[model samples]
Target: MTVSLYVPLASPVHRAPAGLKLGLLAALAVALFVVDRPEVVGAALVVVVAVGLLVARLPARSLWAQVRPVWPWLVLLLLFHGVFTDWRTGAVTTLRLLALVVAAAVVTSSTRVTELVAVVEWLARPLAVFGVRPARVGLVIAMTLRFIPLIAERAHRIREAQAARGAARMRWGILVPLLIQVLRLATTLGEALDARGADAPVTPPRRRAGASTS
Candidate 1:
């Protein structure tokens, strides 16, 4: 299910500092988890929807596109939870989880990957005292964020290619290739970081290549 929940627009939420938005999202998730009340979750969901509309300036249609993808999963989760647990509590927990997920999507849709990296860097600064390198952490986070969309695009292309080759009906063809491609991407990313001396100090070249060399 594709959720038409967010529009790629230059709105206040999009413009706000990523750290602030991240903090808010984190706090909201924690608060929701602690409360565990349907009424509270419903209220939070309302706030999230309002923020998506008013702060994010996302049109209803666009928001639907963003959310539609997860609707089926949400439905399935609700069914599973309701059946396995007490109906009332299961329904509440499912709704709460859904609210949290939707709220997170709103933030991701509005915030750019660069902004998120900056936020992570800022947030990780304090952890440096514990021997954690904030800059390195930020770089990892940035790389991961950058790769998400790329992976999605690659998966789409792979699916299309498989369909064209009349292998779309075969799950392994798409799944296996997608997994391999993602692993390849991860390897490339690691190689790129190593080239940049991410894990250690770099040594200068002992002999430079000739200027006349192609």
Candidate 2:
């Protein structure tokens, strides 16, 4: 069964606009990086956790699922900083990453995929003047998001199959089949998109007589 990142809830966070959540996430990311204080970053992390649990009313597991994958990377980052730079920098950097990841989890868990795509299309509308189709941009972003879980599912299946085949070291063994399947899936999607005319160029609207190019 495919699981979506979004958790259905009747909370205010779920009801909030997707664009607003995205904007706040962006701002949080910037703020986390700009402020180098570990305590401040730790506080931000606590706030994000509170918002996810209290405000968003998301289940703990939902947020944990999104963050669990990055624990190894965070540990490595901390160790790297401790060895090369000061432990303070490493701790602050790790906290920044953890805070960002949790904040993003809260946003994604509260927002729907369609809502995110709509926000993306709206944000990309101004790029129409540069021959960019907002719909296409939105489609790309939507597909990318969808593909992440699909790819993970495929990799899991590959690993299971390899294990069943008595393969002790399945790491390298799974890669070939996984890559082949991903390529096939990409080719099929590309053909489908081509048949649907997704690659067609959009014609620019004619400008008014008094319209300024600038």
Candidate 3:
């Protein structure tokens, strides 16, 4: 089961270039990380959310729903940061990551995964000069984007199945089976790729030895 965060709303944000959205998201992420002041990050979070909601035309309910699933992790982050660092620092870090997550959600919801992969391939084109394959990078990006929702859905179903079987309390047991399930899925994917031409080994370019004077 794939979890779709996309809201089909005709808005400028939705029509914006995937490359531009990705770049802006990257810049904002760096800015949030670089500026550690809680006030600044908190304010930035507000702007990010507003852009995601108002500018991106994402329904407020949908935006909040995407964020809702992250509360447990967010709490853990704050607790860890607070225990080791100051509360202000913790708040700054928490808000910074939350802002990035919201920003990414906005981008992903608006843009198609194929568009993003094309942008990545374009961005990584220069690497081809150094014997690197940009298509591989694009393929990895596409696979990652495709797999995130699937993996999450699988984990959810696994938890539900365990609960139904009276093993709800055995979280550790669920982990083992879930991991094995994921590994099996990976193996199947690998086999499919092998059936295609993607299994070919990509050898690195060898460095030439410098001229030696006898």
lDDT of each: 0.76, 0.91, 0.83
Cα lDDT of model 2 by residue, 56-167, tens digit: 8999998999999999999999999999998999999999999999999999999988898899799999999998899889888878877888899899988888888898
Q: After superposition, how far is residue 32 of candidate 2 from its true place, in Å?
A: 0.8
Clashes of each: 20, 0, 0
Error of 3 at 34 (Å): 1.3
* Tens digit per residue, CA lDDT, model 3, 95-125: 9889988988888888876787699799889
Worst 10 residues of 1 by lDDT: 1-10
Off by over 4 Å in 3: 1-4, 132-214
Tell me the TM-score of each prediction against the true structure. 0.60, 0.67, 0.60
Count: clashes, candidate 1? 20
lDDT of 1: 0.76
Candidate 1's TM-score reads 0.60
